[model samples]
Target: MKTRTKSEMNKIRDIAEDYYIRLGKKGRDIADMLGVTEQTIIAWKKGRDGERTWDERKRDMELTPLKIRELILQEAHKTLSGQKSELDADRLAKLMAAYDRLSKKTNPRTVMDVFMMFDNWMTDEEPDLVVKFTEYHRRFLFYIIERES
Candidate 1:
């Protein structure tokens, strides 16, 4: 049997983690692919000592906007690729809406961009209301900051 260094073992573990969490592979399958024992993969999934478990990592990843977007994209891709029976228009639309909502929540810059564009349009079209709009915009910005905090 060949001896593996700490770095090599860590690299293998990382690959296993990605397969199990990101690619949704089973531990036994990952172990077979990585040429490691199933027990080793199980241990890694459960976490060594104080480290976080693979399930915990997966849950955390699922909670993130980026991960949610990735999942939505994956589902869309599957549908487009004919892996799924048919294109679920309603489901896809809902997923995209959820993705947009999550994206806006994580990225305040999107809100700012939309607000700036609207403010510019208001300034040009309704010049007299600019002062009131400015006050409202200020309050809105403060509200956004408060919501974020």
Candidate 2:
């Protein structure tokens, strides 16, 4: 492919960054969609090569109820799938607690409350399950958000 001119590159970056922030697209995914190298997307995000970056993008992103459900399920799957030992009740409890919050919410406010509960669980380390669960949530959140959008 021919090299993109500066003006053309700027226009592309503007649109791509909008989607990257608004739709939660990953750098690699956006790069593939735009026929650019993933490194170019990373460079654009970093404001290198004179391209603008989507600063404060993470602050704009918010989690939904279904996102929390996927987080819970993915965490459970990750934890159980590679375990050489049996999953103890404590590990199972973490997943159950997250799911329980989702199951009981009947209003927007309550759902947000449940979301916060799970968000806090992301920092938990007692059973180690919560930590790994949080990692999976972070890893999948971008793809899930982009897919929903």
Candidate 3:
């Protein structure tokens, strides 16, 4: 069998990492998909040498919506800071559009916000059920928070 170059091995490892962490794929599945052995994938995940494990990388690289939006804005600023060109302008436009889309009001509100709005409406429209609703709402909110955690 031909030996792979360092760059080729690094490329394969990066793809395997994406499949395993970002896509939440199993080691065996990733190995099969990438034409490697399950042991190889496992070794990569566990950090064969002194390098950090895939799980550690995943934990460190968690991306939230706000973080993504910030990245887009940063990219836009970088694009603007470069020399002016048509391609740079186009890239900037796309980045700005992505930032605007991410910042839109249509983004999901927290469960508490939605529930509080509903509670207020119910208090105004049907004040008699407020006490019972509050009890159930508190339980439901805790359930959701616990599940999310």
Candidate 4:
């Protein structure tokens, strides 16, 4: 049997914590939305929960819309901290809803994940459609990924 260390458990909760932070309009709201116990949220945040439990499959093979919306906001937050662009609240919310509706049972890997899997999907696997996204403007996109991750 494999021994799970404290550090390992902390790491598990950490995934939930960081992603949860990225997930919410407000941190508390996310706790409600994820339907996870509040203790779980705090434990995850404190890096103490070894058994981080909840659905982590991301719906299916594609990125769930909720996750995607979160990513877009994250991207916007990172890429437009002081730039000319901005995401409107109403539009953002609507997009978030759309994302949720579409990705209820799907979680997209990353744009990087898509790119990495391109050849396999093209030759061996057949997806309904192929998707490609250029960096928001190339320069900042990389920075956004770096700063956030």
CA error at residue 98 for candidate 2, angstroms:
33
Worst 10 residues of 4 by lDDT: 52-61
Which is better, 1 or 2, measured by lDDT? Answer: 1
Pairs clashing in candidate 2? none
Runs in model 3 deviating more than 4 A are 63-149
**Displacement of the residue 125 alpha carbon in candidate 4, Å:** 19
lDDT of 1 by residue, 13-78 (tens): 999998988678998899999999999998899988988999998888667777777778888888
- Name the top lDDT candidate: 1
At residue 137, what lDDT does model 4 achieve? 29
Model 3 Cα lDDT, one tens digit per residue, 36-140: 889899889997677889998777657666787766667666666774443466766786677677556332225666777888999999998988988887888
- Give the residue spans of candidate 2 off by over 4 A: 48-55, 61-149
The pairs that clash in candidate 3 are none
Give residue 60's lDDT in candidate 2 (0 to 100): 35
- TM-score for each of the candidates: 0.44, 0.36, 0.39, 0.25
Candidate 4 or 1, higher TM-score: 1
Candidate 1 lDDT score at position 34: 92
Reference-based TM-score, model 1? 0.44
Model 3 C-alpha RMSD vs. true structure (Å) is 15.7
Report residue 30 deviation for candidate 1 (angstroms).
0.3
Give the clash count for model 2: 0
